[model samples]
Target: MRRSTGHPRVRWSRRGAAGLVVLLALALLAGCAAGPSQRPPVAVRGELLPAAPPPPAAQAPADPDRLPEAEPLRSGPPFADCTDDVLAGLAAAGTPVPEGRTLRIGCGRLTVPADRNRPDLGPARLGLTKVTAPGAPADLPALVVLGDTGVDGSARAAARLAAQLPDPVLQRYQVIGMDRRGTGEDLLDCAPADARAALLDAGPERGDEAAMSALLERSRSIVQDCYLLLGGQLTSFKAAGSADDVEALRTTLGLARLNLIGVGDGADAAAGWVAGHPGAVGRVVLDGPGDPTLDEPARTEAVTAAAESAFDAFAGACATGPDCPLGPDPRASVRRLVDRLSGTALPVGDGDSLTAGATLRAVRTLLSQPSRWPELQTALAQADAGDGAGLARLLAPLGGPQGRFDAALATRCNDSRVRATPGEAAARAADWDERFPLFGVAAAQDLVACGPWPSGGQVAPATPQGSALPPVLVLGTAQDPRAPQSGAERTAEQLGNGRLVRWEGAGTGAYPRTPCVNAVVGRALLEGRAPAEPVVCPP
Candidate 1:
């Protein structure tokens, strides 16, 4: 019930305890292959910016707290050395056919030890892509980083932001994305093609001890299998490995300093790296990160509260509309919808049936992006009217998170040293069920998905403090369920030099949610005087 604080886990796309072990072999996500240029992973002139947002009948008031003014770039030096015109020309000319997962971007494979702390561990390859900022001075160093969740398409994030970032932002730095150790070219996937469906069906059922036990056993087996299959290679997939890989990336690019931007768990990876090599990081920004300071139980609690709050916000938004399918009592309608579908399958278009699991997944997906709320309302209406087609459409493209479920489990487990037996997980879920209804218990159970796995991350992140690096800006979404604002607050608090900027709005990293939020971040990075205190950005 407490305010959530954790990873930018869309927790959104991942399925439950069911046959989550069915990881198929490593390959690029369906649409992520480099045959052609598709859209990219993420960034913003917009955080999936809205187009002329319609004025709500009753908009929330802006924060009454004092806001800080941004200072100029005071960092030691730029991360790159390149003329803005040359950079801009590259962008305008379009990304060339990339060498890895994406097309027309700066793709290169960087080699690092599978475990950097242990060089004798041998070499590992990291797939990385760079989107050169349009006008960056070749002599002025700059780099913006996007986390590569094996599932999120490592370079996709860089690709998405390359086009959306303001000219000024792009002109100053090159956006970089590297496939987390396991996902992209270095894929170690074991997830099945029907992995999503299997997980949905086999994941622990709320309040069912037998189901949860089964899930736990399966989970343990999955981890054991992974170890057997991957050997010590699995060790390299941990957060520490990723962080080291990042450091290696800078070395390969020959950048003296990296202006880091981390999204979700990517924040953790960046912070971890900064913690060790503070000298290598110049200006840093963490948006919607998973703070290592939180333990497993706390993470679940935070995620549960955040998710419920977000759902409420969404339902409230819909209820205000006279024709809302969820009716005037959106919360009740949501509960009813879930209850009614317990065992029944609604006939979707084309003779396919929609299960309760699929419905939940669809809702989760819509919740990930505030801009998608309208579509959610429509989907609900359509489902209520006996046609599950809309819901089906929403579920079809969603895989489990930015990385596959198994990879997420591996990375999460390694990061979190929390260990619980299946029975304990079920107990936690049972307790959370009352405090958080629909999402609370399920998430709690999911938190321990790696309980059965024996190996843990190489190093649990230290207190989000001690980075010799300059103060990094931390952005949090007050209502985000996936990446709670609390984590951001802690990240800012823990860092030797960190500042918190809170945005009361929709979206994971609400960078472009409002002019004010973007302005704060933009000015901080470009001009570069770190804000000394926390500031609240309005929706």
Candidate 2:
């Protein structure tokens, strides 16, 4: 929800289909998963127990990683009409779709209302790509793949998805990926470069009342600049509108039911979809899901703890690694490094210096991907040797190839109305040093980024819909630094037929990283059945 971590490279949420990209890379790894000796153990459940604990007695030897054999590409002529032409064609027709050749798979755009309530306000173009059902299309639900946040640059996401899909799935359903409304070619990059930089420089200046006031004013100014830059488009960039857009897409595609799968913040949109069309959706999947009902302090605190747990896991592994740059006491090394940075910034690159915010962001980014643990160790080691670019690579201003910064922030601010005042926010910030120590203050600082958000005239994304629908598969990667397992567990417990599938791992690769996970998900998707009870897959 914060702009500081806009770059997707370091985020728990990656480019393209956030869930699918991670899954594909992970599944490839799982086909030949390495042994414990080669893989660093990240905390998937709770705090770290020991550094480099002995391998399990029954552990089996691992095979070298190999490229997964690609699914046989279907041979066919591409879609007759482009996405825009197809949308226009559908609109010109009535309820029934054209017979010869409907939408197959190609790039297109959907013109949806900028604001659902104000249809006369004109429409925003949403980027889209559709993979039509292969061979004789079945009367199966279409798979609508969603990116975590409202980020774009996922023109290739569909291809990546096509590669990972089980052969059975490709023939049955059409897989769709959207660029939301204000992404892809329609992205709004109005915030001056300096404005985004300033956004990341937000902090309460050690909780000084005067400094807090200055920071609040600066925050307000940035928010105002964005509001103006968005040109009244801010209010409509929320999840509620995006949810309506999803419905429009469904109507455009002429599908009776959609297999809704939302990842990370995209879960909010999926929740909104179900809330609005409870009986219309089928096979709901929320991977790396977030709880829509969680309020502040608790939500921030939960996130902070989750992050620290992951960091501890990484620290433990790093301490045990023979050439660990963090030395024997990784925690102490980090504390000293942070303290040194707080006193004076380190030159990162091109005369740019690493600030506390950038440093923390770099650390958090590295912690999200356990596969990058060695890089984190190296970054720390490089910092000890007076080079900061290794960490600064994460904090550079960008969502890079996979983000729509303006839209992402708007989605958050428009929906989430922070009630904490500057003084109260400062109080929270002051307590973070004691509350969570490592990530607490930064977590609290993240909350302030939402301070300048408008309160009224915004609609809640989800309605009070019944959970008495079809069984939903919620995959929770334990010890996930961003979307922890507890949220997924709670979501499943709340649903009418929701089933919790636990994948014991630190990062967000539970579904694709474990062979058993792939089997479970493939069964659910192909056979239309999830385990009757909650299932657990141990690493």
Q: Which structure among the candidates has the greatest lDDT?
A: 1
TM-score of 1: 0.74
Quote the lDDT for 60 in model 2: 12
Cα lDDT tens digits, model 2, 177-216, are 6665455445544343344545454422345444456655
Instruction: Tell me how many residue pairs clash in candidate 1.
Output: 44
Model 1 score (lDDT): 0.58
lDDT of each prediction vs. the true structure? Answer: 0.58, 0.56
The positional error of residue 64 in candidate 2, measured at the CA in angstroms, is 42
| Best candidate, TM-score | 1
Candidate 1 error regions (>4 Å):
1-104, 117-123, 132-140, 148-151, 184-188, 192-196, 202-205, 321-325, 347-353, 396-403, 458-467
lDDT of 2 at 360: 70
The lDDT, on a scale of 0 to 1, for candidate 2 is 0.56
